[model samples]
Target: MAKFSVVVVFLLLSPFIDGLRFLVVGGTGRVGGSAGAYLCRLSRAEGYDPSDVTLILGGRSSSSYEASKARISSKLIALGLAVPSIEFLMVDLDTPIVPLTATIESCSPTILIHTAGPFQQRTDPNLLKSAIALNIPYVDVCDEPSLCSKSKALSSTVPAIVGAGIWPGTSAIMATEAVHHLRKFENSGDISFPCDDETIDLSFYTAGTGNAGATIVSATFLLLCQKALTFSNGKKAEIEPWIGSRSVDFGGDVQTKTVRLLDNPDVFTLQSSLSSPNISSRFATSPELWNLLFGAMKTSIPKFILEDKNLMQRLAVFSLPVIRFVDSFVGATNAMRVDVSSKSGNSVTFRVIHDDLEECVGLATASFAYEVLKGMDAGIYYPSDLGEEERKGILERVKKEAVLWDFETSYDK
Candidate 1:
């Protein structure tokens, strides 16, 4: 049979019923949409009676999010999922908060996955505060370091979970696992992270750039060249992001990539959440991706190398295509990986791969959603706060529903 057919066949065979009433705030977006679709499919497979569940997608007018809604709903239908009744709204941060709360209360969904955001745009403190007041479990696939920092600070009265996407979710879990297993990784002098015997410099290749655009790309490259954050003897310090540059073979001739610094929220959260004296959230390059990035870097670097042009200038112009491709890809599906290593050199890696990027995103976001809905009666929390019992279940949830696996790298990079 054809590839699509095989997927459909498998969906038909998979067990489905995990009953819950869900309301997805940014339900039309990739991650939220994928979540809705997954629930619908699960509902279908388990022979969910309509009375058993209701997935109300919370988002703006159809004109604004029709494409996302269509994409998700269509996929759900294809997988033989029940057609969930979608609830559309005219939500903008500027809109009166009263109606938003009222709408939410009306649905009173047992779970709320909030994807709507002024996150990187202008981040609304009101929405977060109000969501917390409502006392319903809420989750956001937020991508903001400043905000993650704030969330880290306010893990008390929030009644909500922030940074619900891949980095904060799956990746955060990875760091937790690494920290949990670290047996006396007390390196107070070690500034470099994951300082294995291998190369420290990673030729980080990226698929997407979040709100910061190529500035992030430049920043990442710069991090490789500068001292990055480190924790030694249970204290934190800064070291060169790439002062310890070296190449480790990703698999094949990936040019033995260099690890570079990235000021992503994941790094901040990993630091905030994990107890690793040395937690570095850097980017790496796969061979194919690196070749592409390197070629772009070359043409632009001739001027910088010979004259007064800067690397950032070169990368910015060169990354025009990268910007478009990555944004679209990120917008299309919320998929990523988080790698964690212990000081004693033991490590495990986890990736949330998707049949579609949306699926991967849904896996990540839903994990956070699950935690919020099922966790203790706390105000606010990050994934790092999770206990060992909760941690195992969260990992299990992803591995079972989404396509996940435990891989053993050859004790290398």
Candidate 2:
């Protein structure tokens, strides 16, 4: 009877042992593709049975929605993963929003990691509401600050943690930690104040990629079509996108890099989220990728390419051949540095290192997704509700995977 009771107790908790089914909406895109591929690998490396995961990739419904599933299933098999079913659901800015809600509901996903966006590039009330309607722990890798800032307002509606990718996501976490750890309390140091700020300085850097393909192209059109919101000293100002370019060293090998203010969600995200009196975000790239940057020069004749909707498609086709062509010297890395200081003479800095950053953003985003899913209870939510312990665990996890370094110093005022 005692042994039978034990077995029954074990059976009762069996549901808890199941691996999470992460519904990746844009699972076929750059970030999502990398995430779906890496997630299983990451899960396995961490001792999770990767087989336990179920990935559903959604694309615009073809001639027959059911027909695409076989092809998608074959691709997953080729990757040596289980046959993840591809639901031929039509998704676009115009697709009905409730279907998104129903699809999510049908999946009954433990979490939703959305990467399919150009929300800021093109705002859709229905799509945004559909995303909001899911109301079950939702996260996005959106690179638009407008969406990110607006996402914060929806926190009461759903646990929406926007900017789950690098800049606004990890960088924000780093910024928060940078703010907290860089300053020490004076007499209050004896009591251990986590943070007290009278002054702040910060710089954000991303050497990998930003607003690639149509997203960049379209947002630039938006800038041309409307006044770009300029953020300076925690206030909204106006500025032009390409014209406001500045060259700053995103710091070395990736040295003396020139950066421009690309239309990213992080810009607005940091603006509204932090109390910093001085802040600037730097967009960067390796010198070898000058062509891609040149492609970004929207005002130039080369700008014709920017008008092409097939730009990302062409990139995918050519990326492989180009990389192999330059394999001997085609090196890439992603690094971000945050330097913060207080009036008294205190400072904290963290530098993250990664070899391939396109995938790094996905990794960082997915890791955060995993944690958010693990920690979320029922109803809506966002990262703001995370307690200190959860925050520390996330920071530590990012630091470990990020291979980050920490250095601090203080002196007498």
Candidate 3:
């Protein structure tokens, strides 16, 4: 009878014992590679045996994939963490939907994390659609508006999180928490913080390529050609990109950097989530000369060429040597400041600083994946969609990995 009972228990627990399989598309890239490594680290922290979690690094190039795997293993070993099972799957997102879907299906991943991007030019939510069709949970570091909208449209059909990277991911959560704190203060009757004319300012500074790949450079150049979307008194407006500069204090070694308005999908989601009347996102890069160079390119380069994604990518690749030489000096330090304020002068400020953009983005992305895999309900959701408890949990995890995090409030007396 005892033997039979033990067998039944093992049979019932087999699925859990077998563990989760994660398919990190673009896994060879900085964001994807960091995400996969952090996933392994976080899973180990959760007490899972290293063998229980499997990471399938999906990329088109086998050589790059192998290189990424070896690098990830070395990093994990340096941290004294055991490496999880890592595999490779050949996935070409540029291919037709049929072949891409088939490649994804071959992995049989329990969850799919899409990090491949230069999302600026991608019109179709092909990966999201594939995940829906395959009925696999999905998450992405997409920062593009149209793609995010298309992904959100499919929210009802699948369990997924879009814009799950650092800015659109953790930044969105920070905005939500700021608003919540303000409202809680208002409700306490300490002050009347009306939401009639709320404003949100997102300022970001990434030092020279942030030790990321060429795709980031391509995205930056592409953004230079696009119009920035901002909300003014609850109305939609578009302004020229890389203009409307502001100086923000990130309050650390990265104090007081100049940032110019940039287009980001987070603006749309934050507007809807907080119903803020005015919102804008701005970004800057270090070695100030680079900012000047970007400005010069934006004005001198023909709009058509800058708008051409493939051409811009090629330019970025060609410029990598110069960018890396600069990066060596500026060091990959990154910071973000989210300022939420009301017309009445009540405000909440949240700031995060990290030494490496690639690592922070990966950690933030992995935090979302951890939540989804831990059983977030089936639905398409933004970072703001996370409930209070869920938001706190995710933020806490991010804070642990962040170099510095601070929150402050000021109310007009």
Q: Model 1, which residues run further than 4 Å from truth?
A: 1-21, 43-51, 96-103, 121-124, 155-159, 184-259, 284-355, 401-404, 407-413
lDDT digits (tens) for residues 1-413 of candidate 2: 53354345436754884455666676655566555555554566444566677666544545423443444455457768665433333455455666656765676564567767544444543434565566455667766555555556553343446666665577666666565555434434332232344233333444323423233334334433233344544566655554455554444455455555445444455445454555555455544364354435545544345445355335544554544344335444666666666556666665666556555666776667666544343323234334456566556655655544554445455
Query: For residues 1-413, what per-residue lDDT tens digits would candidate 1 score against the true structure?
Result: 33344345436643552446788876755556767666565453334464466677777667646765687668866866656665565455556678667767676566677765425434454456556566555777665556666655654433466776655466676556654443224334343343343111112333354332343345444333333554554565565433344344343222234555443455556666544445455554333464346435434445334222254547665976866665564442223344555444555444444333446556667666655544345556667666777667667766665433444433432
Task: Give stretches of model 3 more than 4 Å off.
Answer: 1-17, 155-157, 187-194
lDDT of 3 by residue, 1-413 (tens): 53354345546755764477889999988889999999998987655677788999999899989999998999899999888889999888888988889889987887899999889988898998899888787999999987888888775444689988888789999988888787776557322243647888999999998987898999999999999989999898989999999989999899898899999988988876667788999999999999999899999999999999999899999999999998999999879899988777899999999999988998888888877766566778888887777788788888986787999999884
How far residue 93's Cα lies from its native spot in candidate 1, in Å, is 2.3
Q: After superposition, how far is residue 189 of candidate 1 from its true place, in Å?
A: 24
Model 3: colliding residue pairs: none
Q: Give candidate 2's error at residue 209 in angstroms.
A: 4.9
Best-fitting candidate, measured by lDDT? 3
Rank candidates by TM-score, best first.
Answer: 3, 2, 1
Per-candidate Cα RMSD to the true structure, in Å, reads 10.5, 6.8, 4.6
Q: Over 4 Å off in model 2, which ranges?
A: 1-19, 44-49, 61-90, 125-128, 131-134, 155-158, 183-231, 242-252, 288-329, 343-345, 377-386, 403-412
C-alpha displacement of 217 in model 2, angstroms?
8.0
Tell me how candidate 3 scores on lDDT. 0.86
